[model samples]
Target: MSTSLAWESNHGKDPDVLIIGAGISGICTAINLLRHTPIRNFLLLEKGSQIGGTWNDNQYPGCCCDVWSHLYSLSFEPNPSWSREYPGQEEIHAYLKRVCQKWGLYSFIQFNSVVEDARWDGETLKWCSKVRVTGGKSEEFAKEGYVIKSDYLVSAVGQLNMPYYPDIPGLGEFKGTVMHSARWDWSKRIEGLNVGIIGNGATAAQIVPEVAKTAKTLTVFQRTPNWLVPRDDKKISGMRQALYRYLPPIRRRYRASLMDFRESWYDAAVVEDSDLNNTMRDLCAELMTKQLVDKPELVAKLTPNYPPGCKRIIISDDYYPALNRQNVELNTGTIEKTTETGIVVEGKEIKLDVLILATGFKTVQFMYPIKIYGENGRSLEDIWPSGARAYLGITVESLPNFSMLYGPNTNLGHNSIILMIEAQSRYITEMISQVHHARSNGHTLSITPSNCTVETFNEEIQERLQKSTFASDNCNSWYKNEDGVITNNWCGNVIEYQNRVSAINWKEYEITGSCAETLLKKDKSRLGRVVEESNSALIPIAGVVSMAALGVAAYLVRYGPRRIR
Candidate 1:
């Protein structure tokens, strides 16, 4: 049955589910829902015109996925014809478009639609959504202003959409161009111009190589150096693509192995063993030396003083090489502030026509600026005074039927987020299915995870992360927030995350309330379990392995004096 309801203003505003953010994770969630459940009435609310969120937002010169191409995609829909080992933004965007088309998610999407605020209605146990759609588009609701309702809410809005800029004084006074990497404006050309880039993170490193090719003189200002690694990138051969296309398990195994290895390195970096840290540091230095010749000073400038995993590990095929370019200057001096002419670093004042702020995102401030209200007249803003915390990066205790796809502490710094996204979809789809089962049987259902379980879950992660490379007293990074709290990233392997999501512990949630008062089968919890033992042999071990144990050991050595964060 196909039914189209006008905007919330029409009669009573209602949708089966309201999905916020039509990004990769969000789109994936929607597509998976179509594949698994009988959910046809969900509204995909995208603030922008197009479907690609981050891909649309980040149009910087050298934009690409950090993870290898084979692993970065969905397990069900493997693309054999990946041009490069690591696909660029355009390819990833096109892949997403194809995925959407294959699953037919376009009709369900509402372009230019924004959710102003969503509140939980306790009486009905539904989301009372206050939304706003662009005017002059379609007169849906009787008047056009949005106030809708939905049985469930899915917050798939990604973390990286918000751009971060250093509080450089006198930034506006600069007559020259200033742009964040995420908000790159192509119309304002940087051709033959002198450009000053602030903060040498992943984006900065990537941008330097691309912009250097164009700019007359490019100066990269560094606060602290990140551990840079060689990305052995290459175009996927036709034969390799054919192999993955015909034999999917090969791709799957390779992806799993890669994820596992990366996760293991996390342990080595974060673990308390000075021996391990030293080994990692030595290995990183060796790689740096291999890239640059006869420039020990340059190597030192690029080498991180902090632990390997403290900040994000820098990976690039061009970052170090770009620095060696004649026009490019890597400045190790401190940037006092911005001047109208250029950035005044220490005593030297380098003039620039364009200033690019490749300084990462406002990750510490989770779900900021945007207003979100949960159950019992409680605002989501008010709930997270310190920082955002979600049960499995999805649900809040009071917020029933509300799910966040790529929520807090669920981020992985090591491997592909695609793996996590798939698992999340599976878990969510099961929950939605249960809701349907509940309606068929006579009971209202709201999936609420046990507080003990949730708290233990976070505590365990916190304990493990404290000892991991991510929490070491290294250079500050986007990985760590303002308060030095690691709010993002799963410290475990992608495989472990898959198991956690796939294995549903129904005993953990309190399912109460009914969608419709009717006679049907009792909505029993569909308990799940990990298919294979700890040492499963179907896939490669490198893809999804945890650094949890090593991280814990490292924490004990460093901060045995105190508790793990």
Candidate 2:
């Protein structure tokens, strides 16, 4: 008889605090909260069975993080034991799992529990959350769900959860083994077969070079040319590795240093900082042209007409070389449709055996379809149907006591999101501590920026967007939504954002509850922490009352002066 091996469901287990999605950001958020504050009502809820989120899902060939390994790990919990300068997906996944296990986050984590909806009731002052657990013979897909309540709600369901495939004409009719890089089918081999890859984004750029060696013939369909920077991705050496292991502070110091400078790469491009921006532009243009300098036709096809730093720039050490390979052919033409044998381009059918769609994620759809009702029974999707806008990329105006791990415009096209993730996680941890503090003090606090403030921030983002490579009308990029609004990237320095988020002012929010109401009902005139009103009114009122009382006392004394005597 075959053995039945499986893990049980993580439903109906209530903790002090419930976190949705056990991604890197989620794990980091939990870790930071646990480290700082004494409040411990936290539970990490993951949709998948394991702790590693993206690292677990995207297992494509040669998949690796673009950021330097030294800067990728948490600042507080540094790993001096990285194998490479840039770690692969497996290593990254293993690192996260190890961190999760080390901190005993698994005990708090409920795997395979998918969150469906969250509604807030003012009377209860608790967010009623519904979660569904996958896998059970008795439970049907339609009815496998549960409900829970918590003081605070956070949506860490990252921007890259849902995979998107273009509605190309003959997608359902294709007979080949087609899959996204995020969900790479590795059970079967790719060696000695003709393969055609669609979209030349970061994933395709990485996969093309790796699969080229195995596949007999390879073809890449390029919708638009991306500005490429050669990645200095190589193995981490022994001496440096030893330093990291022996001296952990080295990693944090390095990350902080990089965050200050590299994240502002866009500022130069946008500001027209001539000496710096012009130099970078000229250099990128030169490289773009020189990449296939001899092949002018290919260069022309590959070179972007938009300014540098407009789109999410990719780092490829082998993409240019891969395109020059004998077995590979770069197709710059639009793919009209797909035939059973292959894809058609420019009214001509090109034959291929396998089709791989490296077409990225549906990132613009932030927590859509998942019903999240906030303070006023208002849905998050309804709040930002056009796109999400937040004060500090954490708190939404109407969504009270809720925070986002990596909210709108926080993505770094130049630096590692890990840095941004850590900053965001820490910021959220601080907010969690605030919630914990409020609960302890019998107060419900909400840090809501004015609509004017939110609008002003968005306007600034748009102004910067106009100068970004992402906003170029020359091409379509994933950094934008259907409306072409660049809501997914940071057009400024991350360090500045870090500093702004690091400090929290109580004045920014309206703190109200039993404690607040008790204090507030006492006096309307004494609301502020300090008195700033003019003293002339108070002096005149006291003087006039004193004189009136004196005159009345004198008259009564004269009339009754003989009684006491």
Candidate 3:
């Protein structure tokens, strides 16, 4: 075992909550805990030394969020000073850091500590987690393994962190610098080197455009071409930035406009063979044709055979133009194997100084490589033999007191994920509040979504997904599992999902414990307290104004200009 500070840390000391990753989801969860709940004994475990999960890991050239900056950020903490309409990786990472610092979350985060496994201890009524501390050179068990306990567990480890490299034969024997786009090697100079990149999804699309500018020769192996949409990314004007900083109403109006525009494409995502889908397909084709006007041969190879939303629509203004470069060659031939010098494509050896695997992540493998033992020692892998499912993509049956953010079936095809994360965070905080209230009243509450409830929800969503464009067999995408079930996406619009996860129904859960009645009473008491506290804050203002005038003022504060701020 490697070094771990098991003895030094507060290991075995039970916290209120244990969050797995330090990504945007994890940060949002922690912020919610700090703002909305009274529970302070919580910890965040991050395998890496830094935060910003995907943003920190990906630093490749031309890498930026496809979602616009204003809409991609948290609703409570908007960044009015974005350098571009779409901020790059460094800026996003810095934004996360600033949020964490503002909330004083660094003290609660244990860096370089990876969670090995989490087990539900039935006797203790708590989760016993096994953690492994990395970065220490010494091979000592005391410094390697640690145990911590928490009443609740949160899996905030997002989908894209794990890099997927194809098991091409003789890949290990290739005498070249091999890397994945997710794990870019900045040290290896590609200024004049021949580079061969495999896969042509979103990551490859971004990588190729930038690499073509510097590489002596670039070969992009396309398994399937994705629909290219013009990004039209531009720098935000100074006047707009100043207005957003000074006028809250203007900032909110702009955010709403961007949000509405993104939502308008939801019809194209879900309804296959509809007018919206056809119109989008035609527009993407026209855009592709405009970019490759000079090279007719490259146009066909770059065009997608699948529907626009079947695979993710690539957002780039330069990817099509980069494919027309004289030094760049698009190879659609099947790769036979990797030779000692280069990759064999249709029996021809294409020599390369570097080989890059741009294959996407294991999207279906939710809570992957981590053994999550639910009630009676049932593993998560055994439960999701076909694919992962959850009631509202948050809670699962048999996995009591465990919740996930950005989990299965919650990924959106038409909108920003930050919105989803906020919704999920609020829902998780509500559940945490429930557990806290119950436990304080001497009840050992174990909550799992009723199996029937989860099944019904998954069945309805999967059925709708079958009618969606992602069900098209034209391309093999990472969105589906081995069973061809679309486990990575929400089959409806973002507004629908926002409404679904906003509140939790008590009847939907299977609650246990001898003190269940007492817990219910406490739940009502908590609700009453919230109402009374809200009314108490309005008393002083109520004293100076007439009843009708006070009511009007209160309504204005709730839904007017003050609401925007």
Candidate 4:
């Protein structure tokens, strides 16, 4: 780790890497850096008091990971004690804490530390980051903010952390308890109260069922209906857990099977009205029909007009059944206004004691409120006026030595995002290794993708997405931006994405600064092939190959190779 600080602002620890957002991406990046790479000194700045990005923040009732527990976890750390097939918010948060403890990552994390700004310095070849220091004793430091210098910046701040409240008339005038599902207030009472939830996405799918059990009257405002599949969640038997704990290979095989199954669903998500999509739609329609047998009106209102893959598919066994309750009602009318006590929809005033905005986050706006400047003092916001784009969803053309995990176009619609995060983290870790190798040889290295590369990549992806289900004219989804461009999701499957991010192409980037002979001679014994390959196209292919090999091994575990007869 380099402790040298070329520029002075606030006297804080100067690390080799300064990671923003201590969520899943941040933690996974840190784990790779500490264990896989040569980099030791790195700081993880989290806005909240704890780690576990999405899992820690979202604590609403019935909140849980839609993806199965076996495959949703980090590849390196497998948990054998998952209580359910799909773990809830609290369980996920606890799993993260245990992983952190196992790796001793607590020392690297700074809680209540929010990033304010980050600017690249061409002179020192370092990133000077200004972070808002909360939970600190010094009021002056907290107000003015503190500074930290680093050779690399990893943005692990994911897309879904920041909650998005809709622009509704008189939303503030409501005298009742109002909150977003992302920012759930557990203390607020909902028992026997008339509760109104505004949204029909995944969160609402979960909350509707859970809240309907106790609410005196439950009304769900539906702007769009989602294709829902049965979760079929069940408890992991003790014997299965024992098998996972004792025979780790069996667990790995199961995880790999889960991954392959998810990857198979990619076509259903991207290819419009494909066979997989039809099958899913039929299955869901059956589930809906079975749950709401007598109420044809409710069925008609709940049925989606668009194709199955037009929006995200919600998974729940209870959401449909909950809608059939006598006390529950589903409204598909436009919300006109909000009064002091309730909301008016289509000239009907529905009185409610509590309003829950299961409306999601500002996903299109990546790295919101945090000002970032690249080479020549160009702002990231200015560069992305319409929407965000990145090369391989990891590197930007102007932001040298800066990488983002789970950035634009990297979000998955069919599989676990944890797999994607691991892939991106490995790529970023390899980049950090190159920077460290250069610095050790008394040379500063800066890297940024070419403009043509980013433009070409984004254009190709956008073209593919235009034909996908996300671009369906009949339905509106958050995956598409206001411009109707699919900026929030990837066009390919998890394996394809994993292969794409497996290795960095040196030709795609413009690398500056020459390697000095004097400094090279001092480190000659450790120099040759490692440093040379770092600047080549096939640089760090071993890491990628290793991941690919794991996939192959998983295949063999399911079916062994045939012997010669």
TM-score for each candidate, following the candidate numbering: 0.87, 0.84, 0.90, 0.89
lDDT digits (tens) for residues 1-565 of candidate 4: 1222211223354888989988889999999988877777788888888899988889999999999998879878999889899999999999999999998898788778778889999899999888776775433335556677898999999899889999999999999999899888989999999999999899998899899999999999999888877676789999999999999988887886676556656665567877656655665676677667556678777889887778888878788778888999999999999999999999989999999999999998888878999999999987787799999899987899999998999988788998888888888888888887888778888878889999999999998888888889998787878888788898876666777776566767777756433333332112111111111333134334324533443343233332100
lDDT of 1 by residue, 1-565 (tens): 1123454333343677778888887887788678877777777878777888888788899999888887777777778889998899899889988988988888778777776777788777778766566643543432344656777788888778788778887888888999989888989989899998998888887789899998999999988888865566777888888887789778766665655455555444555455555655665676666556545569877877677767777777677777877898889897877788988878677899999998888876665555777667878767666667777777766667777777788887656677777778777777776665665466667776666766777788878888777776755767667787788877676667776775566666666675422222333434353232224652354223333433443343334331111
What C-alpha RMSD separates each model from the true structure? 7.0, 19.7, 9.4, 8.1
Which structure among the candidates has the greatest TM-score? Answer: 3
Model 1, which residues run further than 4 Å from truth? 1-13, 134-144, 256-260, 272-277, 439-443, 514-565
* Candidate 1: residue 256 Cα off by (Å): 4.2
Q: Return the lDDT, model 3, position 547.
A: 34
What value does the lDDT take at residue 18 in candidate 2? 68
Q: Which of 2 and 4 is the better model by TM-score? A: 4
Whole-model alpha-carbon lDDT for candidate 2: 0.69
lDDT of each: 0.72, 0.69, 0.79, 0.80
Encode model 2's per-residue lDDT on 266-313: one tens digit a residue: 443443433444545555555555455445567777877766566656
lDDT of 3: 0.79
Query: Candidate 1: global Cα-lDDT?
Result: 0.72
